[model samples]
Target: MFARASEDGFIHDMVLYYGKTTLEAHDVPLKPEQEGLGATSQIVSVLASTMSFPTTTAIFADSFFTSLELVRYLQDHNCRYTGTARDNRIGKPQLGTIKEMEKKAVPRGTCYYVTSDDGILAVRWKDNKTVILLSTDMGEGPMSTVLKYCSESKKREPVGCPAVTRSYKANLGGIDKSHQVLPMKSNRRYLRLFAYVIDVSLTNAWVVYKRDCKALGVKCQPLKDFKL
Candidate 1:
């Protein structure tokens, strides 16, 4: 399953299908449960892969999807996973009860095979501290293995935020010759589609600006700053 975001950063539609074979692709419309963009994305990616074959499956997630619901979702569907859990809140996973993970004498970067539903894990890549990586068919123990796998990825270079405002005379963020805002929505569908379109247009503009900056030595700025 997969989803396309609307102009307002909402997932207006979704597609769900199964991989008859590896690397298969299918599409479906958005469901009510996917009102939130984040859930829509999670459901789409997971459903797309597991709905077809029922075997030892592996899924990966960043910090956003490390929660009870997501964990239960994967378990209910019969799939293995390796996702980064937050410590206290966003990236914070409460590091208690996992005392067992700390007793070992493994090196910081050494893999600690994590094997429980939730426990402490030392992310050797970050400050070494026990964290959670709930999984079933863990290749190594629990904590270490999860950390090693999660930490193996190279550190991403920091990127600046995008400029969202536009400088075009026509405030037409979407299109047309008029410098005015979007049309007032007469229906919910209109509102949803309009918001989605505006957001996508904004994002597309940012990407273009960033690309141009990289290629033409121009500084990145908002559309408002851009003169026609």
Candidate 2:
């Protein structure tokens, strides 16, 4: 069903990374009673750490990541997840098939995926103002948190987190079928990075700064006064 039957159909994988921070709690027990690891833990670990663990986090995986074992692991560790589940995963009328879901109402339960350890989840959907989101987090009765992962706002990446504006003038490379594209200082995350650095350096005087320039990383060019 994923692939295109028509000649012009297209398919591609969707991947994402996100962060969450809001109400925090001290180290409770890394279990259900846990409030949170506070703010820093959310930034340093949840956002930065790449390693997966028992309590790493509960991320709403896409179809490629819909697995019962992964969700159960997060549940056991106090994390949570929700996402568009897969079509396979047999048994359980409550957790029916994808085709069944299309025929049923918007917010219908369907058997989505299973775990290696024999765990299964009944993926459910809910209609918000915009569109309906499907997930296995029916226990919360139905909520909307859209960050591409972990639809639960409470479990999402820390909110109001400062943006880390790091830059490098890397080559987009190859022929664009146009004139040669020369390298230019560009703000990857956003523009104005150099301006920020300039403002900081102007205020500090002693420290010089540049943004997203590979050449500038090793050593910045000394300012030369152009005598008119």
Error of 2 at 55 (Å): 4.8
| Runs off by more than 4 Å, candidate 1 | 1-26, 29-51, 88-131, 139-228
lDDT of the structure predicted as candidate 1: 0.40
Per-residue lDDT value at 54 in model 1 = 39
- lDDT score, residue 157, model 1? 33
Best by lDDT: 1
TM-score, candidate 2, is 0.28
Residue-level lDDT tens digits of model 2 in 141-185:
232223222355545442211011000001111112111211235
Q: What's the TM-score of every candidate structure?
A: 0.33, 0.28
User: What lDDT score goes with residue 200 in model 1?
Assistant: 47
Backbone clashes, each candidate: 41, 15
Off by over 4 Å in 2: 1-57, 89-93, 104-121, 126-228
For residues 1-228, could you state the per-residue lDDT of candidate 1 as single tens digits?
244332223233334334433223334344444333355345634353434453544544445555545555455556554455554422333333345445555334333332334432223122255534433333322222222233445654322111110111112122221113233444686575666466545555555556679899877775567553
